[model samples]
Target: MRTSIATVCLSGTLEEKMRACAAAGFDGIEIFEQDLIVSPHSPEEIRGLAAELDLSLDLFQPFRDFEGVTEELLLENLYRAEAKFALMNRLGIDTMLVCSNVATATVDDDDVAASQLRRMGEVAAGYGIRLAYEALAWGKYVNDFEHAQRIVDLADHPNVGTCLDSFHILSRGADPAGIEKIPAEKIFFVQLADAPELSLDVLSWSRHYRVFPGEGAFDLTGFMTHLVRSGYNGPVSLEVFNDVFRQTAEERTAVDAMRSLIWLEERTSVALADHGGAPGNDGGFPAYPMELATLPAVAQPTGFNFAEVKAGDSGAVEELLFQLGLHCEGRHRTKPVQLWSAGGARVIINQQQARGLAPAVSALGLDVQDPLAAASRAVQLKAQPVSRRSQADEAVLQAVSAPDSTEIFLCEATGDGTVAWAEEFGSDGVVEGEPLITHIDHINLSQPWQHFDEAVLFYESTLSLVPRASQEVPSPMGLVRSQVMCSSDGAVRLALNIAPMGLEQPHGGADYPQHVAFACRDVVALARQARQRGLDFLPVPANYYEDLQARFRLGDDMLDVLQSLNLLYDRDEDGEFLHFYTATVGNVFFEVVERRARYDGYGAPNAPVRLASQYQRARSGRRDG
Candidate 1:
């Protein structure tokens, strides 16, 4: 899990990016082709600067669209690759990021792609250079790790190994388990990045929206774990190409990039230990006990306040809450909001005007020490939850609504006093629905482009989230970008996705929703509570449920109940995601998930079904839509 960042991850000239990487504590740099060929900075100058700054040129990327071509073109591409290799040697760099063909490729001809790639490797071998061949998600052919690995295996050139990019591995929905079986030596490099969890044609979004790891919806930790298990001991570098990253100050971007690497290092170390140790190896790399690396980062959340419900007819919703043992707490002085209390949590129901449809979460009333103080800090860092939010009649506070808004209102509300309001919202008998949604786990948001990095910094510098380093999503999900801004201690998390510029335009899946995932204590118990709450949900089908039971050996009738509720579930060797849905509130609907031990995925396996369901609902014009 040692860290390195591609120079392209920074915003400025090659020199500026290098200086930023050095200042941010990165160990190595991946030089982008355009940065090198177009810049006034020569290979010798880059080499000199790297030496002075104590940085390694981890990789030289990307020899593009090289495979699946005629010999004439292959020869031309070979010469170009050789020239770059020679330059890398001058700069003391050893690796190259060779991409599978894009324009000159045809899936019908694997031989051409492989032959061209093999020839390029042969040329690089003479330069003593290692080429990390990779599948571009949208490549005419060779668009995934497994496919690229086949090409690499066919080539059988030690200098030609594949680059395992988390973004590429994940966006294509490649089976991560294969990573553990890849010959460690064939794994030439690792490109790490994260993105907002979205269902789209993968190509357009990856390039423009990628953000640091733990920031987006991708399961980067799982990818890295599989990498280590496969015996990969190479430099795990960052290769992000985001428009937002390009606009920021070089130093800040570098610091942000280093933070992502450090964060990934810590996570990978733990994930490896969690999965059985490397058959003989430490089965892990970054877990190498270091002093500064282990220091604490984010703050632990002080728990939550309630699950909200606002209804045009409060009668049904109110009955549901009461049936679930939730009781009334107090009323909002300035708004038409009322509070419900249950077991140390408070859920607010804003019926003030009954603006739209049924009850959805109105606001998240978090307990902070000083509202004014936090507000001041937020201003300094330019990180407020969202601006121009719906405000109450009172001038003292504000929380405007957005497409997907999670209003964090800090006030004299909590007073840092003991957490109040338990009996009301707590389980009266077995409160409601599937109980998949326990406490507020994390919030999912879609940010406009060019501002994603700015939002990350806001959360990192103000709300106590250390933004993961930036990385790009390979094609199909091409160019989509995102990052996770989690609470210091990992209690509270927010995932921000970089929506394509024309988000309002038509694309396949459901439009990005501002949805929140709830984490439960005992999913079984919560499911029972949901049963009592009159929730309208469909259980997982018998086939899926039966398959889950057989695969995980889960005891009890939990599977049957989940099936009966029309819920969705998939369990991995690590953890499982039990998902269920209800009516939509405009474009987004609530997703209640039950995560077993070590489950950190944002429910990707279950995405197709969810998206299809939303798409169907949109066609019918459902409620709150």
Candidate 2:
């Protein structure tokens, strides 16, 4: 039940990464060896920081290539591990990642590997440290969980156990069922990642393209479910390697990664219901709500909201959503992301990007309660203001691309503050920061072409957000440069960025407006249910994941499940994200995002590829006409 993730799972300097991890609400962190060695802060200082953050140093990882080495090298390795243990003791870290003979193994035999490993485990045990043996996908030996488990078993050392990495497990076609056979106690660590369904070299792909749990094409839910079913409840950590993620800002990356965790929780809940795995001790995560199943046919107004606009001209943007039934509410105290109300539902308008904020869309968010305080804190913390707009009063200021041209309105919700959007909106019925919007689940914004940079800065500077490790889509229907933004606190989100121009093909009645995304409890079940109601649902091609399976040779069950729903998939070391886009509404389209533990992003990697495929699918036959 204790959840954990590796600090290295995130991308940044060790301190930044760990802080981001803690801020993202992780209970534990796995320290990479190099991170500690290269840090300006001492082990004691690092330990103190973690304690201050109430975060546990779950593991001091990656004592690499330890197993199957010569006696001289083994002794040297032990000496190295002993030193790390001393630091771990300083930092209060408990476990270390021990790769079994990845690069420097002299012997290939199991006896040699297990014997060498066992001896090292005792050394670690002496330091009161635990060793988690892991298999690299391209390891010299012991390259899978089953094989690593064999080494742990043959070693006969309680101090040593197998670490289950979803990437290595699924990449080499390792079985999840085997995890159940092993004792949960012996399964020392669980690392997760997701990837596109391809037959590329493992190292290159894992290093460059690995995504979070919900953004790839792997069955992390099944793997974890088996672990859960076996009562192996432990820290299920994410270990990812995507270049884009590394290059992004620390806070933005952390939020997106954490959002994937939320998405994964939802998927695991649904998967357990269908596959009969162990039920979560925590509350269940229902899938994103795509239809009006539980949503009131007519939403009631909560009165806590704001709106935004970067108009090229007069009220063009305002007139659009207003026609969609949103009413002009009052102005925000501070910041630019505007607020609009309809019944109880909230709608935000963004026009900051309309003039030149190409990549970013400054949309309105529901009340954050202390808009003034949040804005002041952002400014004190060096969160920049929107260059174009200005504010007069002490009204709760939502951020207008505070960091990246991504605007946000902080309504008085939970945090202690003097400012609240309620007073400004003049609504008596609405409570402050009342999770009025049950779950954003998802949102899509259209971006202009080759202008992901502007979008990136807009969201980052404007909203203090960052792009998740996925893809920058270049579909003909706008440039689709998505940068998902989330609160410093964890929250669900989906920013479907689009390029300015339309796609090459005809976009006839496309309305590329901002829209909310939702996840349903069950897509197939809901699909059937909606069929009777005359809602037009898009059909998925059976052959999509077919190429995925044939190409990657990953597990089959998850592939079939995704295909049945016409779900789009992409993978990296992080995890797999399953996605499906709906046909256009006005100029808007929505994506139903379902993330497995291996995935977190709303299928960013698959966005461009899927868009390309959709274009091919939609416009393929038009040439003949």
TM-score of each: 0.52, 0.56
lDDT of 2 at 275: 56
Model 2 alpha-carbon drift over 4 Å, by segment: 276-444, 447-625
Per-residue lDDT tens digits for candidate 1, residues 1-625, read 4568987777889998888888777788888888887789778898999999998888988888788777777788788788788888898888988887778654457666666677777888888999888888887767888988888888877788888888888888888999877888898899988877776677766777788875577888788767766767778888887777888788867766665666565566556556654223453533322222332332333444444555455555454444344566656544566665444445566676675454444465444555566555444332334443244433354222222344655443453445433322233244443432335676666665644654564455444565654444322232445577666556557777775444323232344545555565555555566676766542233565566677777765866666666667776778877666655553334556678777766665555455455545555554443
Candidate maximizing lDDT: 1
Taking every candidate in turn, the Cα RMSD to the unseen true structure, in Å, is: 13.1, 14.9
Quick one: RMSD of model 2? 14.9
- Output the lDDT of residue 257, model 2: 61
lDDT digits (tens) for residues 334-426 of candidate 2: 534455554344555443335533211345554443455556544432345433344454342455343233455555454232234444443
Candidate 2, run of 10 with poorest lDDT: 291-300
Error of 2 at 114 (Å): 0.7
